[model samples]
Target chain A: MTNSTSIPIKLQDRSATEEFVQKFDTFLFDCDGVLWLGSHLLPLVVETLEYLKSLGKQLLFVTNNSTKSRSQYVKKFAGFGIEVTEDQIFTSGYASALYVRDFLKLTPGQDRVWIFGENGIKEELNIMGFDTSGGNDPRLDEPFDVATSPFLKDGLDDQVKCVIAGLDTKINYHRLAITLQYLRKPEVHFVATNIDSTFPQKGLILPGAGSAINSLSYASDRTPEACGKPNLNMLNAIVKAKGLDRSKCCMVGDRLNTDIKFGETGGLGGTLLVLTGIETEERALDNTHGNPSPKYYTSKLGNLYEFTH
Target chain B: MTNSTSIPIKLQDRSATEEFVQKFDTFLFDCDGVLWLGSHLLPLVVETLEYLKSLGKQLLFVTNNSTKSRSQYVKKFAGFGIEVTEDQIFTSGYASALYVRDFLKLTPGQDRVWIFGENGIKEELNIMGFDTSGGNDPRLDEPFDVATSPFLKDGLDDQVKCVIAGLDTKINYHRLAITLQYLRKPEVHFVATNIDSTFPQKGLILPGAGSAINSLSYASDRTPEACGKPNLNMLNAIVKAKGLDRSKCCMVGDRLNTDIKFGETGGLGGTLLVLTGIETEERALDNTHGNPSPKYYTSKLGNLYEFTH
Candidate 1:
């Protein structure tokens, strides 16, 4: 649903919320801001999600955060008194793995993929039957001395023909140096999980995956094929895998540039914006820059709880 | 000198070389590809410098490599059997220091400058008499864990109003995280030594200072005021500091983008390109992309040795 109005209609009343909810059979929810901020769960997230489930709506948690695997996310949901299966979650890491396997056409067991990220990327890629290296390696954590680096001394690994970069909490110069060596080759395919610059965490903005991805891009002078929100590839993959009707899917996210754009680009039934994330309500309504505006908006995801009846 | 020709005039014969040498009273040299590759001097560099010195030409070694200080560069020169004083060298680190002191108007000793580079940047900033922090800090070398980071616990230091980023061989996420906190504040000034993507080292293209600088820039969503080559500020600083006539000085470098554009933008007597580094004879003469073309070209810097006689 493309709304030309500068201001998104707020789903304040029960009637409007109810009418909006009935329009979609499946809901794609962004996890970081809509469900939780940092570690603590947002207010009424559990109630709202439960209410949506009660309405027989399929809920899939779509997150750009590549730090955690599907199993880890399932555990996180369980910790928060919410039950979410691995099938109900889709991460950028998983998307990257899918892109690598299906698009790049690399034989899983034969080709080694070099990862410049955390365990999430490695775990997801391994699940896809690919041999992975360089993720969370203790050797990469060491201080980078050009002359002493074993990566330079040993030369580039001929086996590793693809590099997938995601958010790495333990990012260091040594790891980047090794990744650069792989990326320097023209034949090595470069992929990034997401290009989100910064994410909201405990009222502070921290460097996101884009920072790591951009560092390599700038050094290698090559742009990586990004497999994240606003790219449409991830949404297409989800729809294809789950066999969800695009006409009955509503995307609920907190970011206009990524989540909202992703929904609009993929031609979802509707897009809902929540104010609990990176975008401000004022900036969202401002029609100055031709930004993707959400069809409906609410203060929190919990606002839909009352309309569940 | 601006050359209208698509191809730069080659300094081949003795008459052309002699004519070129007679035009400039001073020579500004780029270190890496011109004088040396890595840890070793290029062919006939000793003889080249000696010949220029014999002609009573003022020689200033200007480099974008921010890994070493002026004194360190002097040692490198000495190791190569070339006698050069500290004032005769201008590093991007030193240029950043000067920019911080003069342009940023940061008070010496009173104001604190946060460094995101190697000892070269720290040493230069300290020489300018500014209180410096976070360069080669053992604390920042630790693996970055958001929950346990001391920076997150302590919060951003209010005194650090300026962040000068350069090349750091040991760049880590913790260091970048701290830098991002400072940069998040709009009041803080962001300065970069240079933004050269990669540099050739021992037949391998390695991540340069731009990689580290870009990581912070991408994370913070801010553009840093660069003080290195192609910016013209460094050249202006050099000209003013030395009280030399711009018309009498010629720039000699290997890269066309940074080194050649720098001289061209500064309106030097001439900008000479050497094929010992990044640029090639083919790309230099392409003239399709509106790139800053060199006034003259030679196979290597050592070719100038014959002209100096």
Candidate 2:
């Protein structure tokens, strides 16, 4: 996979920046490190996004975080003074919902989608017109006891056709026990919003979707189909839903393994790595992560504003 | 890894039984399924153990169940009308404590062992005289929020030399969060009692020690040294503690991957597979599980008593 282009071209040059910007009609962006880190907006992000908007570029936020719905993302974008519509943002939660509805195609009223996640997944699945159970249920909050757990005592729901796992901060043994009940069945399918092990927030590394997914998977001895970044399933869902030409899309993020690899593997027009978050310029240039290299990189997302001038 | 000896010899034959009984002086036995599954004792379990005891064979109960301590197991055995001492039982909890104290060899006082397990692990560590924290802590029951978690907010303890994981029914995001904090540090060693994904109890398959270990490993991006079953660490520990000759030791278990393989890999005198539990007689003869074949096979542990008559 090595080539002269494997060394990502720095988009600092005015002409090179212009060419890179002109090549993509739609920009798919990762949120955490690119646009903001936690609640704080990164430097010149609004200005750079505004510059892209002035040039008529379609802006779509794609994130592996399954904790927030599209509507919640719209609110988060608004909180940062960036104008974004709910339709333009795709979260792993939404992607998982799409995967369950479109890909798995469970029969309505017959096949139930069991969720081992939070309200974000429930909200997305609800928006998609799918009936789901075990999402942010207060009953799961009760301490787990093998003899008393209704989930364990009453047996599993036979109608569950698929089990979708996402980030669950309220994750407990009860939630995982119910999820394992479905996953252990040969007929039930398993899907993960993302297999990201951890995500950085507020200077603390927090357990991500994979923690929930991995626990259930380990317990059930089943591997789930991931519907997040670099999976191609999430990318296909976005492309088919938006009707965008793959040749005109670019992925921008600070993570090489997720955001950059997602674009590269999906055969998008370009992938730009930003060094404002998890990845560094040296690690990106090292070419040994086994993840696909980004086509171009800059010091930060704000550096792309230089292209407009 | 394949040979003619792969075909396990059935002990139903009188001469074969005699040879098997005469071959080993010390017998390492798995607790669950082999003796009593959950609370009830298996058929003729007492008679079989008595027969072995009458023959002057030293019997030791080695279990992957990390939720119970040696003393607890002694009570359990007593409840089942069996006579056993604390030293005769080697639970995964005790194995984990041994792993932390002897294997990792953490400096006393200066290096504390952090636990992500239940009372069993804590009790064993306390008996081993290692300073431990985070085992079955009632405070971890509080709802997880990034702003409120003391483990997350106060930062990680620098004195942690090893993080030992066992079966924790009270497993929550908070416990995992703190465990992740310690595991993320390069200096902290990771260890697991056993990686048994699920265990059968009350006709329900429940999540096992691997559920806790896998989640932490996934989040921390670290592999733990497992001290249960087929891992020679537990076997070596038992051998070292008992001062037993490997050629005089025989392992009798109802599982192939963990019990039989543990004996086989540890180069014991013989490994006997009992069909009253997880493994079927048909599967034992198939020789396709990628696990080493047991040296002998029988219908149940009770069948061994026939040799004494």
Candidate 3:
């Protein structure tokens, strides 16, 4: 898998699509723009997935959204009339928890992690048997007093060895203060779910997990070891868990930065960019300087049905 | 004055003290650490100010704390047995409001400015006759719903031509969301009170105004036009209002980054770095590549009294 500066092979015709599909046994799909947009599915996506499955290709759904647990994601897939096990889904939440448990090698019961995220990450961490605090804690939502607040005193928990940050709607000053305090200790680990600055919400790009985590990063002068798409941690976790051959896998998604770049950096067999999401075909063709270019490009993921038969 | 890479002149003996004090007529003093720490006044500061006053030297109090209004600062000065008028106190809150009203030239009654700070900024902007919203608003403190929130829709007001961000205890997602929304429009002005990442609180350095503003800056991909110490807007505001000669004014502060840098960048007569605050003498003397060096160094602001006779 040599890096190339040349334009991606456009999979428009049946012959090009057939050649591209035959190269990989497993397909990693990005959920949002590739699978569906909000509550609505894209054109011919159901047929495309069904056809691909009929061809005996393994399917996996990967998303940087750390807002939902794997169980919740499976339920969402069911709502779309698609049956996917929890194992088939890889979210930033699961990846972050796995990274803390396996990579950082923190003792699940003894080591506590302070979370700056929602229930998704909390649930994942809990399932992995890690003691966690500071996420949506009712105490954190309490009023913050600058002068008399005990938080201004010796408020840090010395036992907390890691801080996991993700998309948190309940973000407040106290949580950020504690996170900063923990990060001040040189030995404490800082893990971020993903670094996506903005995610689509109601047709507008709203601040995402990266934005939430970056607030603390800026204040604390510490950077988190991110474990999501565009980073190889999520893919590495999947590859390690499933014992799949990395050379036989392909990443297919709508965004170039997260999906295509994820494949490129993670050493996946190939990357296919579908122009149904955030980026345009013109941008895919343009020389993006240092940005990773995909191996194949198509108008939409639905176009894969051409070779599925 | 010519910029020199040499170490700052240490005013340890009588001659250096007299020579340095004779150089400037108007003295701008940073309140915290120089005059007081938290709530305790530093030794000999009262006598030093009295002696400087007896010598016909003009005095002014400058602080980056946007948590209190000018009247509040005056009250604090009075509590310390210091006689100072509201005009003698210049806070980041006042500087920010003045920047919006005078420098930006936004119509006070007609145009609206959204605030992301506390009562200090709100009161200052109100005093300057500008109608503003979103600072410690009760509505903002309400729980944020990511999925169904109307903030993702047309949440921006067209009349909101400027956004002033400072320290807000009630800082929430909604305020940041609206701030980002307004910043997306190129015509909307983004003003930050100060970029101080941390300030001393109870012997610990806690997150400051810069931390709050930087969070939004990172998310929105926009840089704010900061109007605090080191940026020169506050000093410039005072200079414009008082019609004082810049060569006759000197800035005395404990922190080199805020006070000394503020004086240097604002083109004041001199900068005096005191050892009573955030930085140590070793750090002040270190060749900090791009950091502005002070013209003179003293153990504390009280040491200025050596030249009173």
Candidate 4:
């Protein structure tokens, strides 16, 4: 939890990242359920960021919640007492768009799509230069070529090119039903922004975007293409922006599944599972069988204060 | 699917009990995941039974894959299926002599115990029938006041009740670890008749008697009690003598979960799933939904009939 960028290292408590200054340059952080849950940031996170910044460390606010656009996150940071540019924020929704652009080539004119994700994910798709404008409400629009889950109904006939999934309102079952219908078609591809089921909170675990994905996968019986953490889509994007070697980047977060699993699942480096956030000591003890046991399981960011002071 | 007993009309094809009746009249069904996966039955099972019994309701069989007692299910099955003898083969593994006589106040005598589960799951402080012939296998033959998880690895401090949950390999994990050590306690009871997982197909689900009751529920969580299924300890010894109102008796099954669910998961029905041998169709459909729906959804004996007239 040491803010490696700003906090001066004392003769005592320096993190491995701090000790080996050049080994890791970029720090990727999970936003929701880590930095903040719902609408507020956790206590001490701001200090942690400030300390890291004081050290001149590079930081990226990465998120899997596709509900908001980059502008929204910038606004969120202001509310959290932190000033950040849209360029400083990254989201799985952004990654999903990049993935579609690079891998999913278009043939100039293609079938139209009806999207149900928030404006962020939708805008990302639109940015990719795909012909996707068909109005937000699915019922009023012309029949779309594809519809994503987290919104659409299930069991519809083939016409949908893909079924995309992202965070959605709990009241979005009718939309899910529609998505299920479109996804039932053999031609539709199923995509999920990420798959971290339990989002960490203050000493408790809450459902995350993955809960929405779980429903989509169950109803459609299709495995989703993950575009977020631990997936190449996001990693490639970071590489394009920073032009840094993979070894020079590290991920830190509060939960084990998303933050820690991202390191292993994506073949990245050193993961830190901070106890101050989501996972409990007992849960950490249970996952001992896997390799890379959370590079470091620190109780809290305050613990690093000892190493620094 | 069909109720062979009294009002022999088929309501619907949902339970696999008709198939169990076709095979074993005196059946012991395990509940959970068997009779109703999540919450509904395997499809088209009712007619299968009514169809079979229309020919003639034969010997009826139904058992559970649970550690609870039969009388427990007798109370559960007031409406879900056909009405029958309290002794009509409904069963579980928690039917120790004391659980039967002393706990139920049905018998007058001392209690002896044989365990395959943990001590907490199978114990009775009684003077009449305590199995004193102890030697080794702290689970089977040893002098321990009480049994505990293997993690204890020492001696038991609690008064001996009974040894149970036989030989669970999963006990090697933390769950079984605690239960196995519990067996070493002195002055306890030891008893077991059967151990079956809540699920039998895949996923290494928690089991019933044998080692599962002790290791899974007791060691891992639920805290199990062991009793022989189809034993005099439960309905096993009593069902045959109690002329089953087979016409009023209906059995349900999803084979692995639903059939097992109803049969054993503390449901109120005489149920079991069969591959034509144990489960119903709807349960299979739900379990395998969005993927391959169940074959022989008919749940009729035809599933097994490679060659039928």
Candidate 5:
């Protein structure tokens, strides 16, 4: 409800940067614009991360992107010469899996999920020992008749207890039809990885997980419990996994709506906004977006390199 | 706002049926469930049509189905031994073309359309002398990367002035992306054939034209000007083309939301509800749907045969 665009404390002085770094024992970083954009790593991210590691701060790479698995993220990190373990990366896919297994308390063997995503979700749910169907299946690659297809008659497996929806390139009527079928059941759980309507790639914004999930929600007249940034579930999953005190943790990202709002609502120690992605400093100061204001602002992640020096 | 369940006048008596027949000179009929369901003709439909024609009533088949052209519907009518001309059939596809050509007044060769449907929409638009792209094009049948694809860079023709979306069996992310791209422009028009959330086939309900439109609308944050049943655009198109007096025409269908509401909002003489489709007799009488109550109710089209006899 508050619409005041209060200017955040700019991290300009070396002492100010050092003082800011001393506050948080855990650092949660959003991947895309903060660390890298498309295939290229941003400047100073490697050094800043290394500095945080030298300070013995726990580091976690959190991304709303549900396209890749934790190991894939680790590989991506390694590709950038940043040594990261699978345990340090938290993606929407991994968060969704954790939400289903731990928060929802659905037994892996007894419960099953119907996924509307690609390999990322499948791999994570597989790691969690959960049985899932309808993800990246070539059988569902082609369009199916909703009326006459034998699939509609009795093809849906009734054991599906939850529906995990994300960014699916192969999204079609058949996948949505089955997802709707499960969602219609009162007992079935509906979980969305994230609802970011569009994501930027190479300066062009394209439809994201929220767009697909929006379609399913509109058709089914049901809203999913999202397990991504800004929902607090993803942050809570990390907290529960690492046993970290929420008061000593901070979230750092470029987008205010997803990143800063996530930290604010998720009860993190503080939020830092970097102007390396979608939002401009002028727009961030406008406050009409209704996003939570970050505690600190920097031109980019590279500014934090001064603290390490 | 009116939720009172008012019992419709049941046309059981011969005099009542005769009075119902005398009330309207032109008869607008909804196809599926009223005359036929899928490939099978319903009971007494052929005889009822013959009886209505014998009474010198002008018969028009108005269907919300957007998958088939008027000629295709005519052929469907022929398949059932019921003779109908292309002029006699008013499909959502035909209605959409007319809306684009006459209502929206987008010029041919000057202003183009980006369609999110099948051959039905394409053919009708061609008939209306409008240039169109993206409908059933095998090139767009599969999902395309909206951000990285060269098409997104500048592949879209700037002359596209309108977006027409309907029931496309081969709908994918690419078509929707193109549609959204056009919709983002303030000058571009957005039109939907119908907003029927679901249609019944073989006793099972399947996602309809609204599902696709809903997705695009959600992504684009734009609501389309729907041109199908229940919106009254299709009915108005028919009335304008035929120059028929509104008081002399009546709409007949099984569904209350689409058919009966179309009549009520479209300024028809009356709406007659038949109990062979999506809405049950109990549901029609319940009035909780907030749909216009039909003036007359019958078990099926067969009930009108009593007056002819």
Candidate 6:
């Protein structure tokens, strides 16, 4: 397994970082207030993306927020100079869609879906070839054939197959009531985006999909089948997409919740936490969260090239 | 007090019916399938009412199904007999609304409501001058506001006053999740229609609101205040409305679960069970569910009139 603390010093400038990139065929990035908030991009964000690719790195940006469409994030990323197509990005939403589809053996494009989150998650379900025509309209919350997404309904008698809790407006009482109902059904599957309570936003703290994950797990008496980061599914997907070994890949993230934690738990080459986001080593020490600490931590990213030196 | 055992003979035919009408000052009826099925009326139920009224007696139907509107039931019963108004009817739905509104000091028109049942119940809330504006459409099962209702939108973390469980079409896992979440808070009230496990349909039985009631109550560790018949509030409502002496009123019904049982606990007159719907004398004899048995039991409706005679 890779440790963030062991990131070697041979990495400097675009060339040196490029050498590390060539050494490892795969790369992963974190989303949410990390890339952009709503429609605004962070400073030097575009240069960071351009610098990585010029050095020959295989990049994959992962987000736990399933509320927006991947294209929406793609559009958001593009605004920050990280040019990418839908295929290059992986979201917890997409993983959740696939998980439900395979678990139920639902014929692709056959079952109806009731969505409660963003369009990106919905589009990903579409891309995976699942049917999502419900649009979460209340008139259709009944015990239908199969509903992929567990959108918020108007009342207490709608049927839902799975509760794909990504990011809804707020994890309020009504949502909890429905999720708890489905969870009690021993046969139903409960999948959450990521267990990240807070994520970085323009360098400020914000709540993440973890809040929903925590509530559902506790109320339903079922541990969620997580699909986003620090999990085998996403790592396996990245490895398959790039045709690289999971052991040799590096998952770069500025926050310990995703980037560094993924590197340590997912067995990537190593983790690199940029002070630009999430937690600091001092904070990590104080909290002692995540049994193990990040392998390496840097104050800020004036230049990724500087790390290669 | 009126008995469920018989048709007042005086009410049965002119002068005879008048003699019968002089016997009792108040009446009570159960909701669920007894009142209407979704929206259909039962057979020959109207003539009996006119017969009883012709003899001149007060009537109050007590129900465990707290999902219907008194006005709605009034409108429904109108289809059965002549000239019935909302005030002439009684429902647990109205009782619960009043209890929640008065006991909780809930400003109906001002608070956001996270509703879980039917339109009849919702209509009653509106009539009570509550903020007929809904909180989260319980149909989506996902709560817009987790703790407080969006109906009032107090914008406080703990502002949700109560969760009303009526007949909701979108009651799913999400709604359960939300209900459990808010119920954990001491301030939020968990109110339910009735603890009826199965609702009568034509002849077969299907699960009723009690299922949802059980789900949330068990998971959240909060015993909701039940408002339907057989509950104390229902009995109190009858006493308040009729000015009837509790010792004199006799609860007559075909079901032992709600009507007959209430006599053992809730302070109504003793009970008489008729063999038309829920209970049979054999089952009652085989195992009188609780320790005490109902005051009387007979082969069917109008048998009570014979006993009274």
TM-score, B chain, candidate 3? 0.92
lDDT tens readout by residue for model 1, B94-160: 9999999999898998888889988888898887788898888888888766777776777777788
Pairs of residues at least 3 apart in sequence or in different chains that clash in candidate 1: B1-B269
Candidates ranked, most accurate by TM-score first: 1, 2, 5, 3, 6, 4
lDDT of 5 by residue, A1-309 (tens): 111245677788799899999999999999998998878789998999998899999999999999899999999999999999988999999999988998889998778888999889989999888898888877677567655554466756778889999998777877777677777787889999998876666665566788888778876778999989888888877888899888888899888879988887887888888888767888566656667778788888988886548
**TM-score winner, 3 or 4:** 3
How well does each candidate reproduce the native contacts, as fnat?
0.75, 0.68, 0.38, 0.00, 0.38, 0.00
Tens-digit per-residue lDDT, A1-309, candidate 6 = 554344334233566555545666566777654455545665556666676677676777877767767778777666766689988877788777777776555556554444545466678777777665333445344442112224333332334555567665433434444455556567555677666655543323334566445545554546877887766776776676767777666666666656666677777776655555655547544434544455544454435644443
Clashing pairs in 5: none
Proportion of native contacts present in model 3: 0.38
In model 5, what is the error at residue B8, expressed in angstroms?
Answer: 2.7
Chain B TM, every candidate: 0.96, 0.93, 0.92, 0.42, 0.93, 0.77
lDDT of 4 at B160: 33
The 10-residue segment of model 3 chain B with minimum total lDDT is B145-154
Among the numbered candidates, top lDDT falls to: 1
> How do all the candidates rank in terms of lDDT, highest first?
1, 2, 3, 5, 6, 4
Off by over 4 Å in 6: A1-30, A42-59, A67-72, A100-103, A106-133, A136-309, B1-28, B47-59, B62-69, B82-93, B106-309
- Which structure among the candidates has the greatest TM-score? 1
Candidate 3: tens digits of C-alpha lDDT, residues A209-285: 88877777877888899999989988888998888888889999877778889998888889998877777788788
TM-scores, in order shown? 0.95, 0.93, 0.89, 0.50, 0.90, 0.51
lDDT of model number 3 = 0.83
lDDT for position A45 in model 4 = 75
- Per-residue CA lDDT of model 4 for A123-178, tens digit only, reads 76765555553225655233222233222235333333655676543213344445
Q: Please give me the DockQ of candidate 6 compared with the native complex.
A: 0.04
Off by over 4 Å in 1: A4-6, A306-309, B4-6, B306-309
TM-score of decoy 2: 0.93
- Model 4 chain B: worst 10 consecutive residues (lDDT sum): B3-12
lDDT of 2 by residue, A1-309 (tens): 223245788888778888989999999999997888888798889999999999999999999988889999888889888888988999998888888887788776567889998788888888767788887878788876667876667677787888889888888878877777788899999999999888777667778888778889888888999999979998988898899998899999887778888998888988899988788888778777687788888988988885556
Candidate 3 segments exceeding 4 Å error: A1-4, A8-20, A37-45, A146-155, A274-277, A296-309, B1-4, B9-19, B37-47, B146-155, B303-309
Provide backbone clash counts, one per model.
Answer: 1, 0, 0, 161, 0, 84
